[model samples]
Target: MKIVILGGLGNLGSQLAQTLERDHELSVFDRVDFDVLDENALLNILKDIRPDILINCVAYNAVDNCEDKKLYETALALNCELPARLAQLALQFNFLLIHYSTDYVFNGLETKKEFSENDTPNPINKYGESKFLGEREILKQAENGLKYYLIRTSKLFGPQGGSPQAKPSFFDIMFKLSQDNKELTVVNEELSCFTYTPDLAAATARLISSKAVYGIYHLINEGAVTWYEGALELFQLLKQKVAVRPIRSEDLTRPARRPKFSVLQNNKVKKLRPYQEALREYLNNL
Candidate 1:
């Protein structure tokens, strides 16, 4: 299959490119190659490539920065408008649309309960709202004969390092702080699945190749943990004695409201390994 991966230089996209390229004809385009907000350019590229699958990894995912009113348009353009246009193009060009979403679509209030695909979305922040809107746009296109797959995930980490064009991930920050032997404080109140990019990339390849049911699915590692726990595990894996502290989300006072528990339940495709196993594999690769 011929695949076109947008945001192909980023963490998840990079892994997808690496995993899928083994069996598929792959063409990658990052923001430097073409702005996702540029509808004309995007359509032109899709027309030129004419891939069998268009996997969209592009997103404006600066969670705190997304709360700024001045950046609302930018967020909407990348998170919602881009996917909608891509869905339109998929419909026009007869290609499968695979788009990534977030667990932030949920309110994150149910700590003990896991969120399923059937749960209704009630995003609490602008970032979540925009992502939810993007999902809706894709579904709307589906209603008009667009073949699409929406994969909602959370707490992504990988061996590929942080996205150069985006903010560093939590794992990156914690690992860097460990090297300095400085005390690191991570939020313990929030809970979600920590996904490894390579595992996700593998599962994605299976789903698309198998021609599974075309709808929303949650793709993440099997278990769930808080940021503090994940950080501790990372330090232990590296055999580094870094003093780590646990703090509440409110104590940090971030610009955006985060869901306290947004762990996703993968019901459709359960090919991903456990979070700890995936993390260990990533560490071994490093």
Candidate 2:
């Protein structure tokens, strides 16, 4: 199978591309090569490659920045419009389009229960709203003879991505803060699964192979933890001496409001593998 990954230089895209490259013919496109907002370039790439699978990893992922930007115009263009158009092209060519979504679609009100595919989306911020809009557009296009998959993941981190320096992810940020003896404060009130990029890529391979199940699927590592707890664990693993303090979400003033508890239920994807085992393996590698 031939696969093309948009935003291929990003953490998840790069990992997925390399992982699949061993088994399948893989071509990756990053912002430097192709712009999602550039419709002509996108169309040309789609036509030239005519890939069997199109994995769209491109996204305007800055959570708080979305609040200040022209929410719909900036984010919707890439998130909703371009993907909708791409989905149409995929349908025309009888190609499979795998689009990535987010767990922020939920409002985090349902704390006791893990969010499932059956749950309704109620995004609380512009970022989440834009992502949900993209999902809607792609699903609508898929409805008309387009084969597609919307894999929703949360808290993605991975090895040196496309960056020359290969800086750390959020977890790495916490790790560095601890290493520097800086005071680290994380929001304990909020909870989520800190998914590793390698794990997500492996599961994505299985998902594309299964291709049997379609629509929205939640994919995350096992063992959900709060931001503070996650930092503490990572610090523990690194043997770093950073004091991690817990705080409430309200303590931080941000442009956008994140879901208080956006723990994605991976039972749908867990059938592919035992997530606990996968999580342990990833952490061990780290």
Candidate 3:
């Protein structure tokens, strides 16, 4: 299969590229080569490549920064308008569209209840709202005969780093802090799965190949943990004696509101390994 991955230089995108390149023809488009906001470029690329699958990892994911009114236009363009346009192209070209969304679509009001694919989206912040809108656009296209898969994931982490486009994952930050012998401060109030990108990318390949029934699927590593706990586990894995301080979400004072508990229940697909096992594998590889 000929596959084109947008934002292919980023964390998850890079992993997808690496995973699928072995078995399929892959073309990766990053921000340097292709901008999601540039509709003409996007359209031309799609028309030229006409790939069997177009996996979009592109997103305006600076959570708190997305709340800024100044960034609203860019956010809407990348998070909503771009996907909608891609959906239109998918309809025209008849290619499978696989888009990544977030667990943030949920309000996180009910701490005890794990959100499933069937749960109604009630985004609490602009970032979540934008992602939810993206999902809606793709689903709308699916309704109109576009083959689409919306994978809602949370707390994505991976081992790939060092490139200018490579932003460190949460685990990376903790690992670096531990190396520096610096104390870590993490929010304990929020709970979500720490999905490993390699695992997600592998599962995605399987799902696409299997031709699974799809609309919205929660594709995340099994089990949930607070940020503080995740950090402690990282420290333990490293055998680093760095002190980790737990703080409430409110104490951080971020611009965007976060879901207190955005753990997604994987009902549709269940191929991913547990978060702890994934983390250990990543660490061992590193």
Candidate 4:
């Protein structure tokens, strides 16, 4: 299979390219080499390559910053418009479209019930709204005979990507803070599962290779945890003796409203290994 990965230098995209390069003809595009949003360049590349699969890993994920009107526009353009455009191309070129969505799409109100792929999205924050709109755009294309797999996952962490704007994962940030600061505070709220990029990339390959029936799927690492709990586990794994203070979500003023419990349930496919296992592997590698 000939695969083209947009935003290929970013965290998830980098892992996906690495995972698939040996098995498939892989073409990767990063912002450094080419502006992925440049319609003309992208169209020409697609025309020349006519890839069997086009994977979009670009997203505007500055959650709090997205509350600013200007950033929100950028977010919508990247998160929604870009995917919409790719979905159109997927239909026209007859290729499989693989786009990633987020767990933030849920309201987080259904704490007792985990969110399944079948659940309707009701995003509560600007960032979540933008991602949900992206999902809607792809769904519209699917209605128009677009073959696609909408994978919704959350709390991605692992090796850093080449994107300058790519922020380090929560684990990295917390670890860094621990190094410099005597005390570290992490939010003990907003529960969600963590995803390892390599694990996700591997699962994506299996899903595609198996020719699995897909509509919307959740490919997240198993288990749910609050940011504070996650931080504790992370510190424990590193065997770092740092004081981790628990903080409430309301204690800090943020631009975006986060879901209290947006744990995604993967009832559609095989469950991923627990995040603890993935996190250990990541730490060992580093």
Candidate 5:
């Protein structure tokens, strides 16, 4: 199968490219290669390549920055418009469209039950709003005979990607901070799952290969934790004795409102291993 991956040089995209290349013919494009919003160019590529699958990984995911109204349009463009266009093309080209979403789409209120895929999104921030709308855009295309897989994951942590704009993962940020400061502060609120890119890539490959029912799926590492807990685990793994302190979400001066408990429950597919296992491997490799 010929698979075309947009934003292929970024963190998750790069992992997907690495995981999928072994079994499929792959073509990857990132911001450095061309403007992904160029419809004419994209259509031409679609026409020429006639890929079996089209995967879109591009997103304006600077959560706090997305609150700026000046950047909101860019967020809408990348998160909503682009994927909708790709879904349209997928319908025309008779190819499967694979897109990723986030756990932030939920309200994140405290709950004993994990969030299943059936729950309607009530995003609390501009970034989540954009992503939620993006999911709806693709589903709108789905209503018009588009085959798609919208997978939602959270708190990604792994190797850095090739793009200049690519930000380090949450765990990576914590690791870096530990080097400079003995005492690090992380939010104890906003408890959510952390996804390992390699694990997510593997699960995605399985989903694609199986051609499972096309709708929404939650793919994430198998644990729910807060930023403070995650930071503690990361330090414990690296044998770093950094003094980590807990802070509330309200205490932090951020532009976006975070969900208090946005843990995704993966009910549709085979579950991945625990985040601790994945994180251990990631640290060992590093």
Candidate 6:
């Protein structure tokens, strides 16, 4: 199958492109090459490419910065607006549309149960609201009896196609601080799943190959832990001794609000294999 992945050069998009390339003809379009903000240009590019699958992976992931109205507007364009337009094109052209979403759509107020597709979304920040808008657009506009596999994931990490400008990941910064023997403080309060890019790619490939089960699906690696635990694990993996401190979210100052417990339940995804097991495997690869 000919596949076109938007944000193909991004962390998760690049990883997915590389993995999918072995079995399918692939073309990746990143922000530098094809900006989603330019809808006409995007449609032109898509027409030229005419891929069987158009994967929308580009997103404005700057959680904190998106709080600015201008930034939030741009985020909405990248996350929701363009995706809706692209979905319309997919319907017109009869191509499968695979879009990525976030686990942030839900506020962390649910005390007992894990978040599922059916839960009501109450985003706490602009980022989450934008993502939810994208999901809503897809559901509203999908056509051709199309197969729209909307994969909702979280805290994605990978080696290549990482954030440019040396903007360190939670793990990246922690590793750097540990290397310098600097004590690191992480949030022990907020909770969610850590998804490795390659693991997510593999699971997505499996889903694409198997059933035509469409609609929304939560695809995250197993286990829910706080940022503090994730930092400790990284240090332990590196065989480095770094003093790590755990604190609450209120301990830090940030522009955007974070979900308190946005851990995704893989009960449906676990029918394949728990993402936790996949996460351990991915860590071992590093």
- TM-scores, one per candidate: 0.95, 0.92, 0.96, 0.98, 0.98, 0.92
Give the clashing pairs for model 3: none
Candidate 3 lDDT (Cα, whole model)?
A: 0.88
RMSD per prediction, one decimal?
Answer: 1.5, 2.3, 1.4, 0.9, 0.9, 2.2
What lDDT score goes with residue 212 in model 4?
86
Query: For candidate 2, lDDT tens digit of each residue in 121-202?
Result: 9999988988898888888886687788788988877676884434467776775676666788889966878777887898
Tens-place lDDT per residue, model 3, 1-286, is 9999998888889899899999999989888886678878988888898899999998888898888998976788899998999999989988999999999999898656999898999999999999899889988888788898899999999877334767788998888777766677899977889899999999899898889986878889987899999998887887878889999998898899999999999987765888889999889988
Model 1 regions lying over 4 Å from their true place: 161-163
Tell me the tens digit of each residue's lDDT in model 5 across 1-286: 9999999999999999999999999999998878999999999999999999998989999999899998999999999999989988998999999999999899877565789999889899999999999999998988888889999999998888888877898888888887888799899988889999999999999988898999999999998999999989988988889999899999998989999989999999999899999999999999
Q: Model 2, poorest ten-residue lDDT window?
A: 271-280
lDDT of 4 at 17: 86
Model 2: residues with Cα > 4 Å off, grouped in runs: 163-167, 271-286
Candidate 6 versus the native: TM-score? 0.92
Of 4 and 6, the candidate ahead on TM-score is: 4
What does candidate 4's lDDT look like per residue over 106-222, in tens digits?
989756589999999999999999999999999998888888999999999989988787779999999889889999888999999999999999999999999988589999999
Global lDDT scores for all candidate models: 0.88, 0.79, 0.88, 0.93, 0.92, 0.80
* Clash pairs, model 6 backbone: 221-275, 222-275, 222-276
Clashing pairs in 5: none
Model 3, residue 20: C-alpha shift (Å): 0.7
